[model samples]
Target: MTEEGDQEEQTILTWARNYAKKHHWVLNPDEKKLGIVIRGLARNKQKYGEQYCPCRLRSGDKEKDAAIICPCIYHEEEVEKDGSCHCRLYFRKDALSE
Candidate 1:
């Protein structure tokens, strides 16, 4: 990755960490998984102009696709029920055990 890409990934990682801290959540504990998700987010932001969830496909409609952006509309419910969001980026504390 170029320096620009590295910077972007770091920015996204910082944002994700702050966001998780605010909600009493944490990034996935596995460093490999966390890096993959963060890098995916940075790539999407650079290529698509939005940090769309790396785990989901875009529908090509900005309005419809907005729902899939990072910290997507489904994240809250997914965390509550599944212990983590679909992308496995945000995890409930207890979920880390499993």
Candidate 2:
């Protein structure tokens, strides 16, 4: 990745970490893997005008697809039930101990 891309990834990762911290959640601790997900988010933002989850297939319906945007509608529920978001990007800190 170019320096620009690396910078963008770092920015996004910082934002994600701050967001998780604000909500008492935690980002996946694997820096290499997190970078991949953060890059995917940046790519989605460039392509679709939103940071849709990279793990999900877009429906091509912008309105419907909005639900899958970063911090997606399903994430809270997924994290509550599964202990982590569907992409495993954000998870409960307690889950890390298990």
Candidate 3:
């Protein structure tokens, strides 16, 4: 990857880490997979003008789709019920042990 791409990835990772911390959540420990999802978020931000979750299908309605933006409305519920968000990016630390 180019230096620029590397830097962007780092930035995204940092933002994700901090965001997860704020919510008392943890990011998946698998760095390789996390990096891929971070890149997807960056791409979505560039393409759609918002960081929509890459794992989700866009309905093309900006208002409806807004809910799927990073730290989507479903994340809390998903993490609580499924251990991780649908994309398996952010996960509850307790879930890792189970």
Give the least accurate 10-residue stretch of model 3, judged by summed lDDT: 1-10
Which lDDT tens digits does candidate 2 get at residues 1-98? 77877787787888999999998999999878787889999888877878899989999999999999998999989988888998889989999899
Instruction: List runs of model 3 lying over 4 Å from the truth.
Output: 1-5
Would you list the C-alpha lDDT of every candidate in the order shown? 0.95, 0.89, 0.88
Tens digit of lDDT per residue, candidate 3, span 1-98?
Answer: 65766676677789999988998889989988888899888778767878889899999999999999987999999999999999899999899999
Q: Report the candidate with higher TM-score, 1 versus 3.
A: 1
Candidate 2 has which clashing residue pairs, if any?
none
Q: Residue 69 CA error for candidate 1 (Å)?
A: 0.7
lDDT winner between 1 and 3, please give it. Answer: 1
lDDT score of residue 3 within candidate 2: 81
The TM-score that candidate 2 achieves is 0.92
Q: Where does candidate 1 stray beyond 4 Å?
A: none
Q: How far does residue 45 in candidate 1 sit from its true spot (Å)? A: 0.4
| Clashes (candidate 1) | 0
